[model samples]
Target: MTDKQVLPKVTKITAQKRQGRYNVFLDDHYAFPISEDVMIKFRIFKGMEIDDQLQAKILAADDVSKAYTRALAFLSGHLRTEKEIKQKLQENEIPETTIEATLKKLRGLNLVNDLQYAGSYVRTMARTSDKGPIVIRRNLRAKGVLENDIDEGLREYPEEQQVENGVEIAEKLSHRYRRDPVSKMKQKVRQGLMTKGFSGDVITQILAKTHFEMNPELEDEKLQNEFTKVWHRNRRYPFMQRKLRTKRTLYSKGFQSDDINRLLDQQVDSQ
Candidate 1:
């Protein structure tokens, strides 16, 4: 009887390079194409090829690339803090090792910065309206900003400077409201400034300093000046009725109650 020969089944496929490196594969899946020199250095057999080991290394590199691409796509849509980006990657079930590798690449590119992002966010919100430090701090904290960074950003503007900004707004608005009773006009201006994100204390201080009192002797001259400003605003008011509506308009602007009544009474008294 002839002796039967037993041969091991080769399941893994490894690529061998004549000059550079060989391509490795597993069950029709390409793993990695390792260099010939690297293979020789590791004593990976030149003639005796192993598929199992080659498959493992290739799979690891594939996983890392996949995780990195996912993170890159997310950052393209919106700016994300490092913590936020990491959390998102992890939620997707990406390996921790992959996450670290991806974040390192992102950092090298300068694509993510928590500090700079927080500063721009604060400035934008501040411009929209005068949100106090309390609201601003809460917002930055929620975004994963460090406490020290928040402190530095907020400290850029002192309390006095913020109040001064409010005063400027009040002054510009006050010009249109001169016809309203001084007391009432001041109240309206205060409300306008407050709604604009000016602090209450700042609004009070501005009103106290710039009194918006009514002076009847100067009414005609003030009315002409006020009318010219309103007209220049690009509104075409019939000369007669325009004056009446302007009075009402001023009242709605936060003019004091007494100012409205006095102005109406005076207009009638004159007619």
Candidate 2:
């Protein structure tokens, strides 16, 4: 058949209930539906003739246009890594070829930049959370950010700033544990900072700056309070057993050995 005779003539175009999409009828039979973008791109109109070649071209264009629109919608809410965007599109069952083309389009517009996404993520976490470089790096890696991008992102957080942040957190924890023995309080702060992703060196540096002054009056009060509790709990034990148990308890609680001995001597003298 000649090309003109074989071609289907567009008889009607009607808008579907879906926003910005229309159905095209050829020879009074529904042929295909296309997005407004595709219709405009190919200048599809009633009374136009479409051969098989034109029909294939239009269908391909429509697929790409739809995929691009879906991608745009996905990106509208927040920044996303390239892998995240790909996984999202795949979840929607978009064809692989269309997904690749859509990604290319997004990259061309600088909308799918992994480096930029990583930077934004790092800055947001640094500003809003107590996360250190290790934790932030792990988070970015989980989100499929590239190693180079993650490194670049971490570079934005200076070493001094990390130490400063660590010290700030340590100070807060120190206040909470103020009643505890100095060694116990420092250990608690160190462990707390470690859980928040601070490196050992940074934690050590912060701890080095921390000063736990020996308060003789306060230490005496704390020791007496602890001794009273221990005496009550172990009152039924023999004299030697109760003394040894109290010594062990106070030592484990991080009180100084000399302080424990002096307190024990005072208790013995009183008895």
Candidate 3:
């Protein structure tokens, strides 16, 4: 009769000093350490036969268990997109296979949902931030969300809220650029709102409602201040050159050509 070889058996399972780790002894020799969750998941027990193939499978399971635990910690603070989580897991040197497995499990649990993430992000930014729908869309794209999901999320940001946000931003900008010429101020406010991601129609609406018109006395004061600055800035030039430079600069500053010429004539007459 041929003698059969006995498999290496788990002689004992001892708790490690760590909160949720254990050491497994095979045939009275220390074989490996594993997480408690992994131990429970694989039904690891003393007297369990651990052949080479079973050991490999058990270790693989532990790797995924560890990766899953880490992923959960990453999600403890805030909701994350798949790309963001993958990048983080890669940074931690988790294997691509293990990362994918962890992601699949998380997705199954609905913990890493792009659609939900996008909608929540849009609603938050629309309500709490100055970000417009376009800006939020761009942000979601950078986070690797799909277009359909982004569209679904943007539904939370209604046009009414957009217009209200636009009004607030435009009014703030109008005040910030109040010293600018009415035309210049309007131009600045328009460009500012556009850069802030306000739609063209919304910006137009904001401009129509916002009071950019200042008193004539205030306008004259602003023109005088600008003219004084321009005049002094060109003082080193000849009289003709100085007047020409001031007129050109003031005209470019959104002052009327006629007003600029009148100011130049006044300066010349005064000199």
Q: Where in model 2 is the C-alpha error above 4 Å?
A: 1-5, 16-19, 51-57, 210-216, 269-271
lDDT per residue as tens, model 2, 1-271: 6664567889999999999999999999999999998899889888899999999999988888888887888899799888888999899898998889888889999989999998899888877888888889989999999999999988788778888777778888888888888887888889898888888988888888766655778877887888789866877777778888989998898788998888777655223
Best first by TM-score, ranked: 3, 2, 1
How accurate locally, in lDDT, is each candidate?
0.64, 0.86, 0.88
Pick by TM-score: 2 or 3, better one: 3
Task: Report the Cα RMSD per candidate.
Answer: 9.4, 3.1, 2.1
lDDT of 2 at 129: 86
Pairs in steric clash, model 1: 15-22, 20-36, 21-36, 130-197, 182-212, 184-255, 184-256, 188-254
Ranking by lDDT: 3, 2, 1
In candidate 2 the C-alpha lDDT for residue 85 amounts to: 87
Q: Give me candidate 3's TM-score against the actual structure.
A: 0.91
TM-score for all models, in order of appearance: 0.46, 0.84, 0.91
